[model samples]
Target: MAVLFSVIPLLLIALAVYGAVVVLRRSRQVSSAWSSGITAQARCVRSYTTTNRSGDSMVRTTLHHVYEFTTRDGRVIRFDETDGPSTRIEGDIVTVHYLPVRPELATAKVPAPGKLAASTGCALLFLTVFIAFAIFLIVVANSDSMR
Candidate 1:
């Protein structure tokens, strides 16, 4: 029981660190993509819906879209955009942003700088609260051992 209590706090700390790294990395990637990516027009080739059974027999349906675009160097690239505008249908043209060197990291929409900042701030705030809770758990476990 004592071991379980100590292990739980450590697990929380590990989770906090992992979450921070993931959030920071994603923020950096989006920032870089938004700042330096090349702009191109892509045409929606197909749109499809996928349904899956989530938890407790709940069904979740997701709409997926595939788009194709021509690079400046005369190369054609086809990619999937899952979180794109739901109103887009096949044959609709959309603006795409991608890095010249990493075209696979293309996005149909770049988030506004203010929105990105707010999202990162919110994620970090949650991580801070999570770490504080983990630290409180560690202190409680240690004090109990001392008594």
Candidate 2:
């Protein structure tokens, strides 16, 4: 029992570190793409709404969007995105950003700085709380073992 208590904190810290790295990498990738990628207008070719029942027996609806864009070399690419229905419709034009070298790596928009910072902050905050709680548990377990 005591061995589990001591090991859990280390594992939690490792997990927190891994989560932070993932967030940082994603932030950098979007930032780089926005700075170095090309922009083009894409058309929303198809869209549909899916309805399903949740575990709580409540019905939920999800909107799926499919888009197509032509590269500078006259190549057309089509892909699906799940960023929500928004106000776009079939045959509507949307802006897309893509790497010139690898046009398939693209996004509808670069993440805003404010939104990225807020999410990173939230991840760190959760990690801090989790580590603190794990340490507290270890301390309590050790004291009980010593007594």
**Worst-scoring 10-residue span by lDDT in model 2:** 102-111
Q: How many backbone clashes does candidate 1 have?
A: 0
**Cα lDDT, all candidates:** 0.82, 0.77
Q: Write the per-residue lDDT of candidate 1 for residues 1-147, one digit (tens) a residue.
A: 667877998898899889989888767766776787578999999999889896988998888899899888988989886656789999999888777887766777655878878988999999999888988888888889888
Candidate 1, clashing residue pairs?
Answer: none
TM-score of each: 0.78, 0.64
Instruction: Give each prediction's root-mean-square deviation over alpha carbons.
Output: 2.9, 4.1
Assess candidate 2 and give its TM-score to the true structure.
0.64
| Residue 54 lDDT in candidate 1 | 69
